[model samples]
Target: MAGVEETEQVKGATREDTQAADREPETLYGISGSPGIVVGRAVVLRPRSDDLVRYRLEKEAIQAEQERFQEAVDQAEQELKDLRSKFEGDLSDTLTIMDSHIRMLRDRMILDQTANLIEQKQINAEWALSRALYLVKKKFDHIADEYIRDRFADVEYVVNLLQEQLSEHGQQFPTGFAEPVIVVSEDFTPADTVRMQSEKVLGFLTEKGGTTSHTAIVARSLGLPAVVGVENITERCRTGDMIILDGYDGRVCLSPTMDQQKLYQEYDRQHRAFSEELSWYIHLASETLDGLRVRLSANIEIPNEIEGVTYYGADGIGLFRSEFGYFQQKHLPDEETLFSVYQDLVIALDPQPVTIRTLDVGGDKLAIQLPGNKFKALHERNPALGLRSIRLSLREKTLFVTQLRALLRASAFGRLRILLPLISLLSELKQVQEIIGQVMMDLTDEGVPFDPDIEIGIMVEVPSAVTMADVLAAEVDFFSIGTNDLIQYSLAIDRGNEYVAKMYDPLHPAVLRMISRTVEAGHAQGIEVALCGEMAGDVFMAPVLLGLGLDELSMRPSAIPHVKRLLRHSTSRRLTDLAKQILKCGDGMETRALLDCYLASNAGEWRERS
Candidate 1:
């Protein structure tokens, strides 16, 4: 935290700075939060933390200052309401979050507490307000559940908005663009990104964030090029400077030379052309030239992502991450709430099968009720390999049973399947099956209607699951490879740790062999094998997955069209040959080279256009 530039870093494109630079054409490195290329003039955003002049208010000025605070609150509430109105049903999660902020603004606790602080301490409104929020955040911090505690960030964001409103220094994004421009910031919330999507913003560069940040997720959803965690970017560049952003490589160049600008422009053009070509396959089914069909599905964290599913014409919802519901709410959702969501999703994506993954909470994601209410909070040194996913679910039967009943009840409405997460052993699969059988019997006894023949599957993530895929395949109806976790667990690398992220490779010989083995084992038992993870969404790996004879590939809904395009342009036989050659590679680098060669040789149109 010491080396960091500041806390709560959020700035936007500002007017041109007159100061001279120490060096021209400087390059900064960051994580590729989103993928694309853009050449544009830099617009330095107003600093997120402007110097606040905190001063004690005389007792006589307290009432007037309180009125000023109320006015700021009213303005912020109205802004949020207006923004919330702009989004529709498909963005229900964001809308819900916005609604929460509005409610917070209206909450008497915050207002009354701040007013008391102002009257008692004879402090300025800003100081009193900051103290009030700190007290509230302290309460949040004491919450044993990490998911609930992390909501403090939301509170911090709300406080920032109010402070900006009161100071009359809030920056509104430009609605029009004379030419494309890059928006550099220290950070952006999901709401910020959504608003920017309506403007002429070409890409995003931030001093803080990661792949799983909400800003990153929103950027990916909108298909914008973004780079995050570029430390001290604001110190190096200014508004109106020529900039080249290579999102594919996570590089930002300031005051780029003409030759470099031209090179990036061509790269940008190629990226756009490729995206345009992918759009042509939005309506087409995912199939190779040899007529082998592949089921292309979507992975969703919230119910709202169905918009992308409908937009891309995905075959179905393959991985509905049910744990997000737990994270979003203060308390565990009741059976009815879960049932309603699952039912609505099935109705929305009707006819197409929906594989709802049972709550896969733990390891960077904590359940709201599990740790504090049902089980003791864990302090494990290695929770990734500790009690998580099915392990946690089994230990908390009431929680698991409630979700199972909700899922079973919802299954009556549409083509729904239950997929267990992080399964590692035949015994775990057997125990889960036994519990499902008992739940189904109870439901029947109570005359509760559900899909009597609903299929059950398990995620093949742990190395043990892959090793025993043949045995596990015999028990479950299907297998969905959670490649993100599979790669991490197999390679013993923390994917979230930027220091070692490069070592987390899905194309590693061990990982691919596990996948190939899983597919073979599942197919041998006449069970469908699907991939529902980040790897499934990657275009470079789509053909390799297909070549390995996967029945389905599930990824972010935004990516389905591109994968479909790649599939449409390829042949199953050619992909099989490529896979065979890749399987023989000894390391990830060799495997990557083989894949690159295959794509370059086969996708001649892309090559020529580039």
Candidate 2:
């Protein structure tokens, strides 16, 4: 079949005539999330493992095959390099992740390992390469953390270069579909996402990956609409299945008729107009009609997320989780490496305060290097109640000191604050301070540079932190309640456990009481309190938080402008009164009712509220 660019035009056809032609009724349409048409033959990229040595071969043929294998690796690497150079601006740091894998594949260690296997055992190059890759794959799979485990895909990519068998037949892009090619894959790598051409390719539908997956990230970056985490996507989708992918709602329609396609086209036009209208708020501030100030910042785990800070116009970074560096990392980064990452961030942001949360791991966020026997024997069945956060620091005092030293050193580069997670008792804060003082003294003796007066705060995630707020508030510089965890603990429901999530409520009276008391404790002691959890980013909760007398709020970087707009209409006095009234409410519904009234009242003003 001829590609779209090569299609024989209908007699005397104009551009309008081309688009107006009735889409073949057989065409399938997912919601057209990404709006470009791809006209390429489908080339499936997959990870398939095999026993290479099973292929019996002569020595000379094996030698020839080894050279072929090496050449393929070299060619694949060059192709990756060419792609990177071509897309340098939009995808600068992205290809670097892939390049690392290429480097490893071409590294001496892998080459030597493969050669040793080939010479030591009577195996062909493909066999040797396959053996080595499987070993490497196992090493990555052994990682307990999901993030690191995902890296195994990179390993499989380069290895498959040596053993992949691809056939391109009737896989060419469909001319009869409503648009162009749709990717129906079990999964997509970041590399696949980058190679996707905006003009030729329509959106992608993957069988796996949630909103945070790399596929979603690249799809959003490319302005292509996409639907992910769709079970049985591949089964329902054929090369020419008429499909529509509604990115706005994460829904996809398979095999729609011409009438259905027309309706979707109209829907797409409307949705695009609505999105454009909403985008105007990007440069706008988050102030409400009244005169009140509320801080809006981002929660970031990746250092590459500096774009999120500027893109969203965040007031500052509320939470820069150090756990990503510690947990996803295979080995503990030395003080110099840690300092370099922090220092680069500090210098880049300059005066904006970056609240560095010292490694919050051991259970849900456990690092690889943490001792095995110690983590299990001493750890809790519920790590939420186990040796994590401030307590883990106390246990691994040396690691804590190393991290503290890095934070201090980075502070000299810019405004830096420390946030300690899971500080249920005053003793944890006192112990942390003692360690800091020692590090400061050691730095002083060693003549290292760091701001000794960097403000340190506690994450009010535990019931004890809220219950003993007055006492804990006295010793800490500030407090930021982590409502995601606080709600879980207070309501006795694990958020991750879907069966119990329905019981989780941010508006719960106990949760509200904890937040209000923590805020009161901090303000009474002449300190500031902020909410930096998922709740902080909730527009509905913004007014409730303000009413609770909270001084600052932080959330996803994308949420800043909307929350800021919500705040502009609020005032400390009005919110304070609301907080007082909430204190008198009987249950979570009462709090929800108060929030509903305020939301309904201000719903008209914030053009893109919530």
Candidate 3:
């Protein structure tokens, strides 16, 4: 991109040539893309905002502006309604929220109050609109919850558009640009993406948007590399600059040397090769070289991920997270909707074991505006420790029963297993047992053909669960160690927290001892134990788990082949020695050194996989 300088359009003929020739060197704009380049013009999205003096309006003009303001709001409402109708898949709000919000928007109280501001304070429609929006947002933002605070962004985006129109400026899009163009804007908006289809657009650049924002979403869908928050980029870029974009690295170069271009082209080629190679290993069964069989399962969220499960040759579904449904919608789904989704998933994965955990929301996953009483306990200082998972379910028996009923009912359609989360006490499992029994009676009385003998289990996340594992193991058919939370709880360190994450080592001797005890306890009770957290995918920890007598490993599909390859050369006897060395370590580094030495000495096992 060439920096824009004084143009010949305003300069006299004597100085025009000098001005035109005085252009700065070009700089490239790095954006995400499909590993190719198509040079074209830039189309910038211009957001509309009001430029009128609303405070100076006379009474007659103020009244006129109010009428226009009402009309503009009506137009926005109809537009949202029409969009909802047209995009059926996008309609997430219930009838109650949908109709009530629209009603509140047009209510006399809202309009009268806005007009009162205009008449009483002598403010114009533009200021009135902003102020009213600000007030509404203030109430929602101050509601003592993150979810409600998040809604303020949506409110501000909508009001800003209307505010712009109130000042006689309106939003517009690029309709006639057939050339492959990169969108240039301060911040890319949804309207900008909707108007610029994936085919005609090459890429875009913006100085805003978080990694998960609308800009990044569109870029990923189109397989474009987008580096957001690039300060001073707009001022640097200009028309007709020879630009090369390194989408992989989010690098942009101006008038790049041929060597640099060749480097990126090779990088793109090798990356594609790696993805294709990974896909090739998907359908293979997992087994060690010496004939030790291993159970490989998929960790899934949506029903759509079942295809991936099949492709990865997963023996069964290990963890089917249930919170995604609750979070993706505006409100908690009713029993009927939840049942249908559960039933469909069970039938789809028929003849294969499917472990469904109850809604595991709280800590980072809690919701706001749920009738106040439901999650009020989660508002405490330490949410991860305060009323989460099984505790929350026991408190809200109706919600818990609803989920259990759906899970139990789905069992008839497939091999179903139910897992409880965050269990510290045996009484919590007793609550689960009671809820399941009560729901069974209700379902039987209601003539629902639900299966009665689905396997029940609990995640061994808390250290207390480890302490009481032998007794607790007798109550359930199996135990799945949720090492992510177990290590977090044991070390008092959150993985999300960078300062303490390094201290949250799963290989800490105390953590290793806990694993050994829990596995020993499960074995003593004649129940199966499996590693189901990120540790299951850890190559280093896999040996330790195997040493501790873990029967199964559940993890990301991509890690299975590599992990299985590691297990091929490893003997249970040799692995036991490694675990013993780890336990005898003087410090963490000694344990790590022993582990690394063990892996390096056994490197021959990972190689020459059949």
Please, what is the TM-score per model?
0.81, 0.77, 0.70
Summing lDDT over every window of 10 consecutive residues in candidate 2, give the lowest-scoring window: 165-174
In order, candidate lDDTs are 0.79, 0.67, 0.65
Tell me the TM-score of model 1: 0.81
Backbone clash pairs for candidate 3 read 31-225, 32-224, 32-225, 32-226, 33-224, 33-225, 49-164, 50-164
lDDT of 2 by residue, 1-610 (tens): 1122223331112233333234443333333233333221221222222323455556667566566666666766776677677777775446545556566566543566676676667576667777887766654432333344444555565555444421122122222333355556666665667776533456777766656555565676667667666766665444444466667666666555557667777887886675565466566665545655666778887777888787877777889988767643435678988999899888877787888898887545543334343443553455556677778889888788889899899999899999998888777778888888899999999999889788999999989888898888889888989897788778888665668868888888888888888888999999989898888888787777877777778887767766765676566676677778877888888888987886787567544543
For TM-score, candidate 1 versus 3, the one ahead is 1
lDDT of 3: 0.65
- Which lDDT value does model 3 have at 467? 93
Score residue 226 of candidate 3 by CA lDDT.
55
* lDDT-superior candidate, 1 or 2: 1
